[model samples]
Target: MPVAALDDIRAKVGQQVGTSDWIEVTQDRISAFADATEDHQFIHVDPVAAAAAGFGGTIAHGFLNLSLLSRMAADAMLVPDTTRMALNYGLDRVRFIAPVKAGKRVRGHFTLDGVDEKAPGQLLIRQTVTVEIEGEEKPALTAQWLGLIFT
Candidate 1:
């Protein structure tokens, strides 16, 4: 992780900050996500059944892919040292553009969309994140993610 000054972070607005390394979406991962979320949909857990459903094989749940944004951000995004901690604020918008089937690789491209001071010590950080599925033309999803960092 890199600690950046507040002023330096402000300068990165509207620009891509970083991209995370590729992460393989394996069956185990999908299963784990499903178990954790109690979303054991057939398409997400049964390969044979999912194969017949036109997905070719079991596909990761859209929410499963969406939940990975945090790990992706932690891998590549820089945080200011003045910030004590960060919290998930909310998403302005999110779209599932494509399916993330099992055995595919994915990574996130993080862009600093905007930043605003929510209060005296907390700031709202807005970011536009694109989760790109490797070897695929279309992305898995795009979301306007928000976070509140307390200084």
Candidate 2:
């Protein structure tokens, strides 16, 4: 993670901050996510069913990919050195543009969208994040992710 002064991010708005290394979306991870969520959707859990249904094999759940943004950010984002903690505030816009098939590698690309002082010790940061699926033209998802950091 890159450490920056709290206010230093203001100038970086609209620019790419960083990108994470690729992570393989394996079947085990997908199955665990499905088991945890109790979502046995054929497209995400049953490779045979999924393969017969049109998808070459099992695919990842969109929400599973969405929920991984924090982990991905932890791997790629810049945080304020003075920050005490950060919170996953909310998202402004989110689109699942494509499916993340099993066995594909994915990575998150982050761009700072804006920053504002929400309080004396808190800063609201808006980031545009795209989860790119390797070897694919279309990204798996594009999201306007929000966070609050306490300094």
Best-performing candidate as measured by TM-score: 2
Error of 2 at 56 (Å): 0.7
Q: What would the TM-scores of all predictions be? A: 0.95, 0.96
| Regions of candidate 1 where Cα sits further than 4 Å from its true position | none
Per-residue error for 13 in candidate 1, Å, reads: 0.8
Clashes of each: 0, 0
Tens-digit lDDT track for model 2 on 16-115?
Answer: 9999888889999999999999998999988899999999999999999998897799787888898898899999999999999999999999999888
